[model samples]
Structures are given as C-alpha cells and as structure tokens.
Target: MTISRRSLIAVAAAGSGLLALPLVARADGTLDEVKKRGTLRVGVTQAPPWYSKDPKTGQWSSGLGVFMGKAMAQSLGVKFEPVEVSWGNAIAALQGNKIDLMFVLDATAERKQAVDFPATALLWYSLAVLARDDLPVKTWEDLNKPGVRLSCAQATTVDSFLTKHTPKADIQRFPGNVEAIAAFQSGRVDAVGMFHPPLLAARQKLGKGKLVVPTPAESVPSSVAARKGDTAFVAWIDKAVGEYYRSGQTQKWYEQSLADFGLDPKTVPPIIKEMIT
Candidate 1:
C-alpha cells in the first residue's frame, strides 16, 4: 500500500517530542546511522490506541507504540518516523529491514522464529468477545458449535483463535476490523472478536452490547520486535523497555491513553496486572 504523503506528514507531526524516524533503508551502524540521519524509523498501523488516526481531526495519536517509540527516538537523539504497515506485513517489514522496529507485536512462539522478543514486555492484552445481546456466547464451547456465526478480522490473532478453537463454527472474515464490526452491528453475524481494549473502543462507538469473556482471559505479551540478527538495536530496545517498565512510566502512558481513546479504565483486563506489576 502506498504511504500517502498526508499520512507521513501527520505521523511526523504527531511525534513532536519524538526523534525523526524515516522509512528508508536500515543502515548498518544502528546507533551511528540513526544519529547521523537524525531519525529513528518505526512501524505503525491504524490499530486504535496502539496507533490510530482521528477521522474527524485527521491527526495521528502515538497511542502506546508511538508513545514508547518517541521516547526511544529521544534516547537516540533523533526524531521518530512512522511507516505504514498492515497487520499482515508488520513482521515482514521489520525482518525485511523496511522498518527498524515494530513497537507493537504479540510474542507468539511462532513469531519468535523470525523476530527476537525482549524480556521486558510493553503490555498485555486479553482476547474478549463481542456478541449480539441475544446470542448465548458464554464460553468458547458455545461459539464452537457448527451453526453459531462468528466474525473476526482476517489475518488476526482473533481469526486464528476462532479458526483453531472453533473449527466447526461458521466464521465470516473481513479485510479489517471495521468491516467485521459492521457485519456484527448489522446483525449479519453473532459476535465480533478482538482484544478487550479495542472492543471497549468499539463499544464507545457502537454502544456497549453483550461483551463477554468466552473463557479465562489469556494474557498475551505485546512487545517491540526487531530482526533476529540486529543484536545491537534489539539490545537497546530491551534496555529501553526495561527502564520504562521499571520506572512505572509504561503504566502511566497506558492510563493516559485510556482516557485519550475513551476506554474505561475499569474495563482493562486483569491480565495487565500480571504484566504491569
């Protein structure tokens, strides 16, 4: 997908305190190159509080990833530049050297094959269910039945979760979360699957419906990812994230983001307690 000049400018502007990150080639001397170019390139997507664009304001909010990326850029004494990447290509963009860092990533074992996960996780997410009030989606088993209809964004963890756990259910897939939510809102599907926070954001826009936990919310670690061999940059990321986690700075940004995105603080999953503390 073409990165619109408008999008680039918005990202560049959003990160006022951030060091300039450009979407060009990854230089060999990680620190030296960034200092010389005066920018630190990071990847982003329109994935709500993580990274999102305001339709009304036409502005970009760093959310969590960009918030953290900005700090990293500051440490490097450069500006943060965000590169447009889809959920499907975020990993590839990092591993292929198209982007220096992917600030938001799920640390699945399979993904660990291509990227290195730092010991310090940036945050955790809970997979939650959003179903029609009338639908009886009390558990994963209930959604697993052959006739029950479920919708999840394509190429997402939610999609893989439903496919792997509820193979018998009728699953309708959409290109993105917006389309999937539209299907659910229109009563064409039973439930919309996503992380709890994004679902909270959806509820703000689509009224709070029957949002339920299908099972015990599984805490998934979300981290910054880098190519397997970029040992120096990866180590720096680990140090940076560890410091943020230790100083309670990450939690601070998270709570502020909750307010910024209109997500109710109480609705944040208990899994965060395990990760944050």
Candidate 2:
C-alpha cells in the first residue's frame, strides 16, 4: 500500500488549491469555513475498536473515524479536531457547524437527502445479531422470530435495517453501544444488533464466543458525510478519498488498525476492496 511520489504531489496540490474554489463553501454558506478557521472539526463516537479515547493521554484513537479524520486533515491541509459525540448528537453537530465531517456514517437514502456523502462504500460494514453461544439465534432469520429481543443503537442504520427486514422482531433502543451490550449481558435481550468489528472486540473482551450474522441484503454502505449543499467541499473530499483508495494507503491502515484491535483483516470481503479500487 505505497503511494507513488507523483500521486502524493498531486494530492498535495489539490489540497492547496481546494480553498481557491468559490464553490467550496461551508454548510453555513462560507467558503472553506473550517480551513479559514484553521481547524477541521470531525464528528466521532466513543465506541471501542471504532472510536475511543486514550485514557492516559485523553486523546482519541482506535477507530476508522480517527484514521479518516487524520487522512482528511492531511489531504486538505487542515488541523484535525475531533468532537466526541453520541449517535443522537452526531447529526445535530453537523447541522450546527460543530463538526465539518461525520465519519463512519451510514449512507442511507434518507440521510443522503440531507447530508452530502462524498465517500461512499468507504467500508462495507455488516449488521449482525451478536448473541452468546448458548442462544439459538444463528442467523438473521432466526432473530426475526417472536419472543426474541433485539437491542440496537437508536436512529442508527442497524435500526433502519431491522425495521425494513425484521419488522416482526421486538426491537429495543439503547442510547449507545455500551447500554446495548450491557442489556445483552444481563440477559435482558436475546441478541444485540451491531456492526461486525465492535461485536468481535466485545466477544474477545468478555472471553465468550458470540455469533454474528450479516444483515439481510439491501443494507447501505457506510460513508463520510458533510452538511447538504457543500458541493465544493464534497468534491474536494471525493478527490482525496479517490486518491487514498488508489494509493493503497487505506488498505494499509485497515490491516494495521484491525490487528491492533485483535480483529482479522481477512474478514473484510474481497468485493469491498474491489469496489474501492
């Protein structure tokens, strides 16, 4: 995953000139407002193996969001400023100009109608029903049966996926992943609906085996999003992401980061790499 010197220079050139474009306006109608202010505010959650804090330094680490923010800032020649937010607060943070970009966001049709998604298919995240090995739930279809409680984050893509495909299942909403996992551990829920990486980490930490099943087909891609109408910013971001993908830097980051979290990079489907390439 090496970037050629020529491509690196081209990316740097693009970043330096992105601000000169009149169309690269902020969500509030100002050009490169984030850069003009000298900081790129990024939205992220505190979910482990996805987004989390370094207890010793009080700095952020360990998530795709962190890497995405770092890469975005480097490509755009801006300072990276992370805003730790809950799932509930993420969208408002973007709309209120508290954050310039939301990473690890699900690009649903409903959300796309509001936010500008510059990087689509950044990661092919799977929705899974994580359950203790003792549970009978082994697949997406099994989770749809009656008397099974499925816990998920509120207003998340998992919720929407469940609503659309497993409408009959009893769905429970938690404020965040911690509560959802807590409920599952307490036997209050039959299974927790979550993304793949976090579920794998949780199982490792608990020293228990958890079963994970992919969501039914028709799930959306996860993406990086900006406020609606920020076409210039979106275009600039699109170019940066394309360059990163082509350079193979993204694959390198994935391999290293996933290994750090005790997850297997081989779990990423080959088709996802093809799509990004």
The candidate maximizing TM-score is: 1
**Cα deviation of 173 in candidate 1 (Å)?**
12
Per-residue lDDT tens digits for candidate 2, residues 146-188, read 7878888889878888877678888999999888888887888
| lDDT of every predicted structure (CA atoms) | 0.73, 0.66
The residue-by-residue lDDT of candidate 1 on 76-112, one tens digit each, is 8899888888766776666556777887677766566
lDDT of 2 at 75: 62
lDDT of 2 at 190: 78
- Models 1 onward score TM values of 0.64, 0.61
